[model samples]
Target chain A: MLTLVSRNSPAAPSGNRRRRSIEGGWKQITINRAFLLPAVVVFVFLFIIPLAQGFYWSLTDFTGYNPEANFIGMANYAEILRDPSMLSALAFTVLFAVGTTVIVTCLAIPLAVQLNKVFLGRNFVRSLWFFPAVPSMAILGLVWSYILSPLPSGVLNTTLNNWFGIDAVSWLSDNSLARMSVILVGVWAQVGWHAVLYVAYLQAIPTEYYEVAKIDGASARQQFFSITLPLLTPAMVISSFLLLTGGLKVFELPYTLTNGGPGFATNTITQALITSGVSQGRYGLASALAVMFTIVVAIVGFSQLKVTTMISRRFS
Target chain B: MKSRALRVLALAAGASLTFAVAGCGSGGADDGTTTVSFLSWTGQEQMEPMIEAFQEANPDVRIEASYAPPVAEYIQTLQTRVLSGTAPDVFVVAAENKTNLIQSGAVVDLTGEPFMEGVQSFNLDTYGSDGAQYGLSLSSWAAGYAYNEDMLAEVGYDGIPETWDEFLTMLQKLKDAGHTPFLESVDQMPTTVSAMLGAQTAQMDPAMDELIFSGESTFAEQWTPILEDYNQLYTEDLVSSDVVALDGDQVRDEFANERVAVINAGPWIINAVEEANPDLNWSFAQVPGRDGGMPFQAGAAAPGYAISANADEETQAAAKTFLTWLASEDGVQMFHEATNDVTVTDNFQPEVNPVFEPLVEPIREGELYLPMISWQRDEDRLNIEVVAQIQRMIQGAVSPEQVASALDSQLSGS
Candidate 1:
């Protein structure tokens, strides 16, 4: 309504005139600003403001409950760094972030390529792959908990025991195995959704490029490397950033799977922040951890954003 | 055209955001009849009948309830809701939130509310502070080792030992017979400390809590011996530190399905055990402690209804009416029948699952005291520390005394 009203009046024409005047020297700024206004609004309101609030809280010892909190400077950061559990959770979180990003990217591309082809029950296959991401993590966790139970009576273990004549494996008990199992489950839950994402982007690539390469007597592999790979770089940048942040901020799956232990083996930074801040009533400490975590996350996120843009620009 | 394509992409992303936010902001309440979102930690199947009873009783109060499993998830979900001001009018505030729930003004403080009439003091005190009750606790639970009777016979022990020393000796005998003696999940803090503390409370002129909180003695002074005594199983190689890596559910699963003689468990898991291994020989017993000490339990009061302080007098009264009915004979029976809890009210003697009978008395009689439950300070913080320190203790990374001392330091730190 406001936009319509403004457009209908003569006053906005002068505003547009001012814009045109500035467009000579600041033309790119006007263009970029116009193009990005809607997205900027969304990113600022939903993401930026909340992140700023979170960062501010991190600086203060903002116990989640108290209406009043005091600024404790870098005390929270100092404590979190010194604390062993948070460090362990951070280490595991990084491993998980890197592991899933590398593994899922490799898996999803191939999986998307296969699904994009005409095959028997192709739709059915696609749905089956996508099914894990459909359910809430809580439900999936309950189901997977039983399946990954360390006992011989556990679903997978019992099946493996009978079918393969093997002993029961403690999928969630041993520290390293628990970490691996959590990562494996994470990949299982997410890879399909990501594959579907790649599928959507994959369909967007022009067939003319592939055809042109074929017309040049290029083999399928040659065409993929010369044409398809370069085009997919933009999508890769987007997908990898999502995966990195998603994996870093992962809480539900690991919490559901292991509750951050055998002994803090599979804990994540967010989980530690939450468990300490909310459950323990150390909101101030928690907010501090959160604030610091946000800074770290922002640093990582911005660096990845820069790297992805560069890669995409190189491809362009 | 490029901008149009970007717009299409943006719209798609926005649509997915709608989907994502929709999933969380609303938790799948489809029947959609003025849904009163009830957040429970109870299992889904267990809540069905109780919900049915509520619907039957108050047809106007169209209820929509969902449960996060238990402990951490339940706490996390409630925290999110409360912090975001999206919490249900009614929600479970177990021991983990007993302090913060009250201090944060998240729960209703029913100091002299009408719904509290005829409610037992033990249940009230479970979720209460000095004089004000925050929750209308409906049930109480006491967990101990669920033992195999036949295994006791094989080890030449007729039943669970009455004394802590006797228990250790019995464990040694079981080890001698080449069986895994006993397994308690150290992924949680030691239940025996709570049971022993409860025992001490029963004998105390004032209480263990009073003395400990008054600084008469520290946790290290009180619990070090108990932890060391408990560690006899590890030191003697009757059981490995493997148990420390396991939680209550895993322990219960092992006891139900494995050849292990005993598993640390509570009444909540009886149904799963019955369904899985109905023929398994099992019965509950109080965890043994120093012989002269009172046979105390390691249980907590069940989550109950709390009147929202923000609600108007009319809504508060209406909510009170509902809660009062829940504590009444019919309501108690209905809820107990559904949840299979050890409901502690003189008004109702619920026909619980037979396996839970052994725990019923201890739970009802108010014969339990866990240190975390009794902590004058932050319960969740101390509990997490204890659980971690205990895990390290069992892993041979730290000594039992060190674990006790760590608790003391953690308690004193903040």
Candidate 2:
């Protein structure tokens, strides 16, 4: 509509003048587009080329050792589809991605709101919450494994037994509990960072809006719902996107904690990819899995963006 | 601005010249010494002394060593190098990569090398195909039950039993005495199952893996009974099923702290266990056998040094010289003192810890078997299936027969 208005304006330039203006605009545009060359090069080299190579390898039996692999065509994909463990891995990967995203978002916002208040030692509290994000997930997983071990001597189990006479729980041995433990540990590791993101967004919200709400006799809860929640949609979009993608790509936490057992209960696609490609030397099959996983991630990521955009529009 | 540009170019030229000179210095100094690049599987602290000893003995060969930690990282690094045509002059050929290395002709055959003479045939055969030995393996390792002597004595046993039935009875006795009988990490293949399978194979005319891989037998036919026997540890409620969640370190800690009576372990745990509890009375015993088979261990030759086929003849010869010294008595002694591994070369007797002495003979005599090392092909894939399925069996989600049949299905890719 704006383009149409500009085009139909009554005081438009003459034809020769417009020609000269467009020529000038073309040179300006060329210079501007030249600034994008480095980024384009990086994207091509880092993402697109590797993606294309992976797709090509997906159609062959390129074990990591030899370059002269035979073209096998769809066999790797078919094998993935047929394998029960691979299917289970897919199920758990989706569950983890969706589970952590929802739980973390639900928990992080309230935590962020509480942390945003002018409480005593606010900086210390924020730092305390953010400490879990400092260490690698692999380290956290190792520590949590010992804490949540199923033995009577485990840290959590021993505490429970001492304090409440509770029995040992199979934290990592049972399928459902193992999945839940991994997701919870993931949430523990990431919730602080996401909350910090929310706190940043919360700080950006104009203070005058809340003052005006107070003058209108709005209560704290009413003011929050009307003023704060609507404006935080953009933050939600970014945080949830990050959470979903990180959760999907999770490998180390589950790997160090459960080693994807007691029957692949916490297996992730990335674990399968590494195990097959690097450890088993079945790079072709791993490439096929990677390609499929990429498609899945793209679909989920875009669908999330669409939903978040719709929510943002509704709130706006 | 022109002067600044000239200064930057001059600095860059100086840096390039320095790097070129340093690169030249890394190799032999053109003094008839040949530099052999080695990608070591051992950590730097352990491998450095062995390299120094070898270089001191053979001054003509300068060892340029780089280290990658074992198993996955080392394999991936070496694989990338081999494919990119930048592999070291010598690298460790492990069970994980032996088949691929041999099939791709990435390693030179060391069958007739004098250094290969005193090494055990089992070590040679592990990295060989069709009688062409490729790796000089100087050491072997075995895993068995590392039992706490005090706890076993409390249960009226001085050592681990030699038969499965007696072992189960002892476990029951220990449990009755309010003690944890055994703990074996099922994160990898269970040591108990591997030992039982080894015992079974030792008595078979053709090795069990040979029959199964040759298609004359199936996992269901040969492995179901053993799987059932192993499952007894969990099913009879003697040992906890939570072991599926435990790793070797956790189990070792339990034994070290005297919280568990016995745990399946290898020599690698010796230092940690001793350090954790210096006065802990412990000894290693072969895993008990079943149905009158002899006791055996789950073990294999340690990763061996293989000269790269891609190296030039001179560097390859230098690599060979390194391996020859590595297999010598003095070199083996230094390696043993550094790494605490039982060297299997006949020229040197590795003085093992007294607690670990019982399993050392079997390691030296090559009476060890690990399914991943013995499988003809698809080792990693089959290993993953076995572990997961066995965990499922322990959890009561699958039967022993189903677990064995799952391997058959995995092997057939069905």
Candidate 3:
């Protein structure tokens, strides 16, 4: 409606009158504003409103089942900080985020580089690599649970035992191994998808740069280091940012795989949040944990984004 | 043409928004008859017939029903609906959410209701708080170790032993007979451990959690021995430590395949076990006693039917009718026939499978326990923590004492 009004206000035909030019600019502004209206409405209603409600609930004693609850100041937040389980969850969440980010980035870039090359049955290989990400994480977690089951009946354990005469390894029972198994499955599920993203970015880079490097007596390794690696930095920036945030909020994989057990070895903050808020009816404390989690994630995500962007710019 | 297309798009969008708004509204009709909306945690196949039966019996009350799958999903759906003031007139109050439901006054108090008469007091009190009943629980479930008859006979035992030592001896004999002795899923609380603790706590002056929360006793003191006794399977190398990574389904499968002679299971597994190996003879028994304590089973009242306190008088009345009918012998018999749950109403005795005959008396008499159902407060949080710590204990990362103290810390922190 505003776009139509602004369009009609500019009445001068073809002539560059100042009033007409001003109205034309107004017409452009109105169109842009009109285009953004739906998104802004969605953002305010879906994101901003819920966030404000969460912030309010964090300061209240809302038990999730009740609509009427008293404001309790910062007791929930204070309690969360003092809680040991939350601290353990926080530690593992950070470790998972950082570990998955570093490891997946290292693996994805190389995988993408290889996937970019022409080979026999290249499409099949690419599809095979990408298939893990196609299924939901919950399904993958269940599948991996069976594959990595500590029993000799598990697929991998049975293979190891029958083929090599090895004892069954307690893949998800030990604390360190549980954490590592979760991260390993996480890395496996993610590396292909991120590599696919890198593959898209790799396609965008001009062939001339690599061609020039090749012509200048550059080895395959040197060409990759000088050109391909530099060009893939933007993908790295986006990929790492996503991995960091998603890893921080991860619940299902760890939940289905080990249920944050063998104790709270692989428990993430979001799992804590869900268990407290949804399952345990401690919505107030969960909201507080959520608020703290959001702040931590935002700080880490934004800082990592800034660092990666700077690095990418330097490389460019 | 472009302008026409834009107009068409706008019309479609407006129509969709209208449909979306209309779709989100409550489905219960109000056409002179009372329409009581019900949300069931049980699946539609189990609940639909009951709704049909209720609607047939009470023509003035129209029954509208929906379902959310059990446990976490059901609790979350009910919670969201209750907080939004859109909860159904009737819903299931599960162990995990009964505390919240009662404390928030979200459920109707069924105290002194005629429908509650003859209903098992244990089932009623499971969802009750402060001497007021909120949920009309109809049936209860008990889980214990189901053993293969042939396997036990091969080891020269006709039935499971009453004491822990004799049971371990039987397990060792089975192992020595070239058979896999036992398997219990440690995904949640171990059945053997919970049952042992249940037997002990049932005999205590005050209930276990009551004494612990009152500061008269500590979990570290009370639970350490139970933990040690339960952990002896692993310590004595009678059961494989790999059971830590197993779940109920896997254990059930192992039993079905005849790879294992015993497994922790409940009536829920009866059909599957029968279907898997009909020729194989199996029977259920309570977990063995320790230190002369009576054998007990890890069990609880089934999640119950509770009316919403916020419902209109008409809907509430209709919901009461539904609950009364549910507690009635006919309703109990139908429910039992459908779900095979041990109905606990005094007037009704659900016919049991011969295999489950051992548990029939206990279920009827309400001699079952689950820590989640019995705990006075912080039940869900404590259960999660305790389960995780127990898993840790099974993995040898933490001692039984540390695991018990973790509960202490969790309770104090909460």
What tens-digit string does per-residue lDDT give for candidate 1 at A1-316?
0010112444555777787778765867777789988998999999889877776776776656555768877777787887778889888998998899889888998898889899899999999999999997767776787898776667898999889998878687778888998888888988999889888888998787777667778998887776667777867888899999998888888887777877678888988887887678677677667776777788888988998898777766
Clashing pairs in 3: none
Per-residue alpha-carbon lDDT of model 1 for B39-93, expressed as tens digits? 7777888777777877787765555577898776787777777777777666776
Q: Second chain of candidate 1: TM-score?
A: 0.84
- Location of the lowest summed lDDT over 10 successive residues in candidate 3 chain B: B23-32
User: Could you tell me the TM-score of chain A in candidate 3?
Assistant: 0.90
State the C-alpha lDDT per candidate: 0.76, 0.91, 0.87
lDDT of 3 by residue, B1-414 (tens): 999999999999999999887555443344556777889887899888887898898887777788899888889999999999999999999889988888888888899999998988988888888789888888898998899989999989988899999999999999999999999998887888889988998898878878987889988999999999988998899998777677888789788878888899998788898999888888999999998889999998998899998898767887888888888887888898888888898888788888988887887788888887888789988888888888777777789999899888888877
Report the lDDT tens digits of candidate 2 across residue range B256-356.
Answer: 99999999999989999999999999899999989878999999998889988898877777788888888888988888898888889888888878999
Tell me which of candidates 2 and 3 scores higher on lDDT.
2
Q: 1 or 3, which is superior by TM-score?
A: 3
Q: What DockQ, on C-alphas, does every prediction get?
A: 0.24, 0.75, 0.59
lDDT (tens digit, per residue) of candidate 3 on A1-316:
0010112465546656766777769978888799999999999999999999999999998899888889999999999888778899999999999999999999999999899999999899999999998998999999899899887678888999999999989898778888999999999999999999999999998887767666778898987887788878878888998999889989889989988877788888989998999999988999999999889988998899889978976785
lDDT of model 3 at residue B179? 94
Q: Tell me how far the alpha carbon of residue B101 in candidate 2 is from the true structure, in angstroms, after superposition.
A: 0.8
Q: Residues A1-316, candidate 2, lDDT per residue (tens digit)? A: 0010122557978899999988879979899999999999999999999999999999999998988999999999999999899988988999999999999999998899999999889999999999999999999999999999999999999999999999999999899999999999999999999999999999998788887788889999987788788888989999999999988899999999999988888888999999999888899999999999999999999999999999988787
